[model samples]
Target: MRAELPLAAVLLTVVACQSPTAEATAGPSGVVTWAASADRMGDGIAGRSYRLVVHTSVGGTDLRIRLSNAFGDRPITFDSVYAGIQQEGAELRPGSNRRLAFGGERTVTVPAGSTVWSDPLPGRLPAATDLVVSLHSPDAGGPASGHWMALQQSYATQGDHTAEESGAAWTVPTGSWFYLDAVSVHVPAGTGAVAALGDSITDGWQSTTDLNRRWPDYLARRLQRADTAVKGVANEGIAGNKVLADNPAQSALNRLERDVLSQPGVGTVFLFQGVNDIKAHTGVTAEDLIDGYREIVERVHTAGKCVVGATVGPFKGWHEWDPAAEAVRQEVNAFIRTSGAFDAVTDFDRILRSPYDPARMLPALDGGDHIHPNDKGMQAMADAVDLTALDCDTIG
Candidate 1:
């Protein structure tokens, strides 16, 4: 935690920082190589410098990052920013650290409820690499925006140490990714990307931290090795997020444009949400969830993209599991499989469920929570995705 500073001290006005007029200037042509769904993080800290570590999917030249202040009530200025390759812990690979500028300036202020992308850095980033982004906010507070459950350890410190490649200055370890939301690279002209819009399962819950074992991570590795044009995978998943309602994390439907459609080179959207809404018992029936899926598919198609719907994985052993919810899940899964509303379908329930007990997760795949999957289960889910189905040719 940051030193306890008065709210007034951190809430410096935009004029005080001498920030430029904030706008989301369009970035260079590229594909999103990595992404994490953003939500309302706790209040920002004054003089907090964050060294956020993000894993790359499909790497290419001219790397860029998107910083978000989507939930802030006032403008926030990022005075200094740097990108580098992680060598160990908080240390960067020497000579790989490079300064990043926003619209040709070393600093950029992002207004409330907006996101800004930095100009592309000249370099070729390989696949499955750990890319590090270090930044400092001189004066920041109010509602901060970030990805909540990173499942990857990051570093932080006070003051502007954005240019440091040594881990000596960064002594604090944190799990959440602050400000940075997405990373992109210019790939082959025809190459495209896919966004996995899901909940905790897709958010990598129960998987080992710092080791990218999330299902989407596995899928990314597969895309790199296989002969698929859709090589980029963006995990736009938030824990406890739902398809119908918003709370701590915005609902999938509400955040669709920002998290998925708006991302660069997105050709496919994999929908894997609904367990939260179904188990919460918020008077949401199979029909209600089905309607939500229809809307997502329709909207994605309207954006000239393809949509892949996954059946809700079985969770009979979870604390919230009940016969009523199971019935709704079954009905929803049935619709997802046979209705043909989606551009394609992945039967996650069929893949993760125990053969002996239709409604229970396989013991080997269970992450102890019954709802989330272990590392092996995450691999299984990724293996079940047909790489060919991600092609955007299916789009109407």
Candidate 2:
């Protein structure tokens, strides 16, 4: 079960698991949305482009791409769009590029507040490589969404909101690139999947925009190195998601089955939530947080799945971090390290916290928000994982 670390003024580190295996598998088919920005509150202007580059292993036979404007109120317009293989550090020019068609036409109008999957294209993918996709926008402001990875490096066209005359090219420096939506890679059968279920910390917020340095990415890299039978980690961390009923965006208890259990062939879960409830102003105490975690663990076990609990890290400087909340944080951390409700415990708090400053975060890991970790901080969190819990050969 799950356990927690003791309340002591000491630093602790543990080498719990080995490198994981990584192998590319067939991705889903039939209109998978590339990416969607549900909230369009941010700025969409010139020089602010959203790019996605997907890392895929060779051997896929068919591929396709799409664009999303799920949060936009009006139809999104694009001047140009292009897709091509990633070469060296950028997308290869038209000789290796393909034009995506919308309704048998090069340009298409995506209805407001919805997603449109791409029409399939005939293409052969190599094993273990990156696909760089890029997009551009002529108009200064438009609602947008972006996928974490794309195969094409540039998309350019005649004017804003116009895709009909767009052409696939080596490079277009004028228009603003929007975002890469999604891609479909054909894979052989019998491929397993990994899903990292957590909060915004796992959403790759502060990490370099497209470096693919998130912990789940790191875990995928590890698995690739080990030749594990698993495919890749589909990240399921919503920025504001939580463990209890406090978060309105669907709590962990409410979405567990859908986000974690309902996923296809999931072998492991890395639980990295609950700090929200502990630091929330609702007065939820430490014991209450533990009970909430316990309930989640019980449900995961009932599903015949292995669960790993990551101790809630400190948030002393957070807006809600008060003495009362700090006390609860300590209590919850202790329970996570010692309770044994989970099959294994990951000491994320210990690894990310400052040994010199017990009350605050380590300066290096702090994203300046004190509540979340930066790129280096995220790397540290990924480095803290103990992969042995997923070892069916050794796990009890």
Candidate 3:
């Protein structure tokens, strides 16, 4: 038996005990290969199981998972969780499923506005593989936390079915991923990662589901084949999200720490937001938007990471289009193209804009919405990213 200490002393002791091990495991070699931004869930369900299928960007050993309750008003308890390779619809490959522990315990209770990482599972995870995370919450309710739009098909069911490897128990299909937000692995010493911080375009909206056609997904493929050391990719985009304000999701600035910087081995932040802020007719000026971008760049730089800024794409035909908003867009794009504040810049407006109109998306690449990009446009955006820009080693 041990004697109890004051709460503050106890907290300090816990931190002291955890820091050394964290520093060791994160030693210059580990990287987060995949991530999904956690947003406030619309509704909460009790006693349910979820098997989320996510595509990996880089292969490595000692795979780990991060569970978030960032928006919950109460603590959430996860009794069981498993990680494995996806064989087919909700089915895991034979002998691939493995149980995960939290702080040496099988169960973990995440407090509101907090996250917890599972102890690393020893094994090899291949790049581009469909990795599935199965989780069961004994009591999950009140402002649930998750990504609202996954752009992929994941399965859910009632009760404690997380330990099952077959698809039979997971009968309900879900478009959103619950609780689990990130997966990481131990890569070669020189490997690193990039976090794409943007809106629906970066979120793969309108792209084919279950195909891994997001621009970040394409970028991952490019990194794998290129001669660069930046091999990990984390897509942190939300549909209808804004850079300066919160609505569909928290503002990019507000969530940057949790969504971008906190991931292991992140070397750069890819900023590709602002269209929503300009089009909302919220009286946001070009200067206001530029200031937001500058803040993001400064904050990222302070964290020892590089910033890659992309010019806002044209949206002349969208419902909210107007001359005033178009003027703001042009001004913002000019700054993004000419401003040396960003460590690197990608001219997405130049790559996706129609040559004939110069103010609209190319017809062939438009996803019919004129605002979001089709698969071709998504691929084109990824292609335009200079693989070298993502491999900056001098920054954090």
lDDT of each: 0.89, 0.56, 0.87
> Which residue pairs overlap in candidate 1's backbone?
none
User: After superposing candidate 2, which stretches have Cα over 4 Å from the reference?
Assistant: 1-191, 245-248, 298-304, 391-394
* Candidate 3 C-alpha lDDT tens digits along 1-396: 464321112111111123323532353247998899999986567898999999999988777788888999998889999888888999988777778877666777888888888776766777888999999998899998899799999999999888888999999999999998998988878889999999999999988998999999999999999889899999999999999999879999999999998899999999999999999998999999999999999999999889999999988899999889989999999999887888888999999999999889999999998899999999999999988888777532
Give the per-residue lDDT of model 1 (tens digit) for 319-353: 99999999999999999999989888899999999
Clashes of 3: 1
Q: Which model, 2 or 3, shows the larger lDDT?
A: 3
lDDT of 3 at 145: 89
Sorted on TM-score, best first, the list reads: 1, 3, 2
As a whole number from 0 to 100, the lDDT of residue 236 in candidate 1 is 95
lDDT of 3: 0.87
Q: TM-scores of the models, in the given order?
A: 0.94, 0.63, 0.93
Using TM-score as the yardstick, the better of models 1 and 3 is 1
Worst 10-residue stretch by lDDT in candidate 2? Answer: 18-27
RMSD per candidate (Å) reads: 7.6, 12.8, 7.2
- lDDT per residue as tens, model 2, 246-328: 35456777767645654445556668888777776687888777888888878877877677888877777878788888888
**Candidate 3 global TM-score:** 0.93
Q: Which candidate should be chosen as best, given TM-score against the real structure?
A: 1
